[model samples]
Target: MAAAYEELDRDSFAALTLDRLARRSGVHVSTIRRRWRTVEGVVVELLAERSSMLPTPDTGDFRRDLTQLTQAIADFNNALRNRNVLQGLLAAAAHDPRVEEIVRAAFVRRIEEVTLIARQAVERGEIPEDTDPREVIAALAAPLYYRVLILRGSIDERLVHTTVETTYQATVAGVFVRKESREGNRKGDREG
Candidate 1:
């Protein structure tokens, strides 16, 4: 299937049929059909595989831990074929919202893995208990997205340092605290 995908890089998924993937993978067409209901399913699984390239590691250093994760993301986007595949996915997504949603959701789900860091930070009192994991995780990834997708800039050591530092500082400043929690804190202060 990967061979077929490499061959069909510039071509549409319609070019990838069960027979074609079977020939490329040397797997039986019936098995392929049973495992993957459609070409879209095969693509989704491939995207999932790519998305999971970054793992959530706990090095006992909160800032360093997230920096490593973001660095992995940067490296993945830096690969030429991966970038091309992403652009192709985006083009396909323009006409197919389902594909867009699936890919987006898969990436988001992967991002959620970093939420463990946030949780650990809260437990260690490194950050406020009300800090939202989703916000912190989003902050960690947004700069990488901007660098790779929007600005087309390169991700270097400085960018990685700044990204981690900025998120860490923001978290400490309560920038990621939930709105309701902030409101309640204000009320508590007034009462006190």
Candidate 2:
């Protein structure tokens, strides 16, 4: 099964049929077809496995946390290496709702993990509690995504640090004011 999936990265699945995968795996075609929901399932599983190998941050600093997140994304893109695989999968996703669902779920899982780290920063007062963790993470990640996927640029450590620092400062400035205003309102309520 693994060998078949590895071969998939080298060639398009459209070119490699179920019979070929079964032959490569030394399993019957019906066996492979029965267990896997879609041919993409094997690929999705490979992606999920790769994602599991990413490092988690425990640095206690928001900037460091953001940097780690950005690095993980860069690492993921680097590991994939084959940009055509991603493009092909995305093209398939446009026509197949199941592929789209899997892709969306995978992305949500990754984003939520980053959000949890930002939430921890809020709890530790590294950032204001009113700061939306999701927004903060998006600010850090969106540019990296745009640079890599849209702009066809690189993901360097310097870019990661700059984006993380900028997002952290901007998020603190925006959210801290809201926190102060809310506190003031509470104090006024108590006095009244």
Candidate 3:
């Protein structure tokens, strides 16, 4: 399946068929159908498999960790095939509920895995304890996604530097503190 995907251009990927995949993979169409149900399902599974290879960096320094994470993201997005797979999957997700569910669950799992960096940063006293790991990670990644998925732009070193530095600064400044923490602080202020 990956071979089939590799042979096709980004535009052709969206139109990929089970028969084409079966021919490329030498698996029966029935087997492919039974396993993945649809082309989008197969692609999403491939995405889950491929994206898991991205390491969650833990350099014990938050800034270094963020830099590693950003570089990994930039490297992943720089690959035309990875970008094609993501574009195909997201386009499918918009129209297909089952694909959407699978994609969403996969992303949630990845996010949970990657948020460990922020959790470690908190443990290392690099960021406020009240910082929300998910929010911090999201801020770090959102611009990259916007650049690749929305603007169809290439990943550049400058973008990686800006994203890492911005996220790191905001995190250390308590910008990503949990809402519960913010509310508690507000209550304390009122009482004081």
Give the winner by TM-score.
3
Candidate 1: which stretches are off by over 4 Å? Answer: 4-23, 27-40, 185-192
| Candidate 2 C-alpha error for residue 152, in Å | 3.4
Q: How many backbone clashes does candidate 2 have?
A: 0
RMSD of 1: 4.6
Clashing pairs in 3: none
Q: Which 10 residues in a row give candidate 2 its minimum summed lDDT?
A: 183-192
lDDT of 3 by residue, 149-186 (tens): 89999889999999999999999999988766666754
lDDT (CA) for every model shown? 0.76, 0.68, 0.84
Question: Please, what is the TM-score per model?
Answer: 0.78, 0.76, 0.91
> Candidate 1 or 2, higher TM-score?
1
Candidate 2 stretches greater than 4 Å from native: 8-20, 81-85, 175-192
Candidate 2 structure lDDT:
0.68
Check candidate 1 and list the clashing pairs: none
Per-residue lDDT tens digits of candidate 1, residues 1-192?
Answer: 475557465455545577777877888888888987756667777777877766886887777777788788788777655665565567667878987998789878876777898888888888887788888999988998788778877678888889989999999899988876777745443212
Candidate 1's error at 156, in angstroms? 2.4
**The CA-based lDDT of model 3 is what?**
0.84
